[model samples]
Target: MCIENKYPHAETTRIENTLGQRPKMFEIDMLVPNGDAFEIKWRDATTDGDHITKEHTRLKVIANAGYHPIRVMFYYPQREQARRIQKTLETLYAGVGGHYYFGDSAWQYVRDYTEVDLLAVLNRIASEKTHGE
Candidate 1:
């Protein structure tokens, strides 16, 4: 919502996925037209090892479409398995010349890219809820 509100032109893009046996389409999150592809995640706690491969394939598809792939994960996983997966994903992103932002960096990326202070907005919402405004 924030991205759409800030950049009304930003839209989800569908790309062909040839990694699977049968070609299908993959919907990318918040793809800015003629700009980088942004994949925003609130959290990734998946311990499944296959997740890394899936992400790699998705990144390749995004890049193949001539867009730089950028991943922004707001929350860092606490579990060991999940952490390993994140670490692996981070490495994969780097290997593919993609950008990965986790935790504070992720928030900063959103703020800088969108020119919006997400923390301040979130705080205001919290205050409104508390005061029943």
Candidate 2:
């Protein structure tokens, strides 16, 4: 794992917290030496998946290990799916002592306030699509 330039002095590490007695280890996405960790959930992370059962344990392992883990859930363009996942993710993240973040795109999650101009972004994307056409 590489040290993030912002956290240069902090070594990055990965932890394998097994999903169950079956010995399936779920790898943590990222962790910093200074006790900051991040675990990501991709598209359609509704509570119905097989791995969903083990998510709480995974988060507990990270937090119990002394890191302030954050759970970032990716967003979908589809409104219903996105809303469902966002609601579920927020509920889980709160239960496990981690921060919850979700966005229409990854940029929205990381950007500081006042920089999220969705209209401008959509317009630029539309213009690019026109070029391809």
Candidate 3:
């Protein structure tokens, strides 16, 4: 089965296999083959306004899907809040079987898990800017 988010919020792919009546589908934020199922929370998505406990629910869904759901807190200029956010994400990830990252280190963790060449992408952007491309 093919899963696509196409939702304003985070996306999950509906992985499935035919069983009895229909296919068993799992909606995970991101399920990389033998890698990680990721749930990215930007800003104060966890405790902002009425969003308290929302992240927890999302992570739970991933876990119920039989995937290790990783929660990544994305906080940039608000580095001071990173410490608090990291604590929250860590606590949740600990309860689950996945992992988490915050602050400047967030991108690094995601890159490692997703196996994306972030440095190369950034270098290409820099080169283009330098060469006015």
What TM-score, over all chains together, does every model reach?
0.90, 0.60, 0.58
Predicted structure 1: lDDT = 0.84
lDDT, candidate 2, 76-128, per-residue tens: 43667546656665677688677876665444653332245544666799998
Worst 10 residues of 1 by lDDT: 18-27
Report the C-alpha lDDT of model 1 over 1-133, residue by residue, as the tens digit.
6677778999988888966743388778988865778888899877696777788888887777788888999999999999999998898888778899999999898898888878789989999999999
lDDT of each: 0.84, 0.59, 0.57
- Selected candidate, larger lDDT, 2 vs 3: 2
Pick by lDDT: which candidate is best? 1
Q: How far out, in Å, is residue 70 in model 2?
A: 0.6
Output the lDDT of residue 68, model 1.
Answer: 83
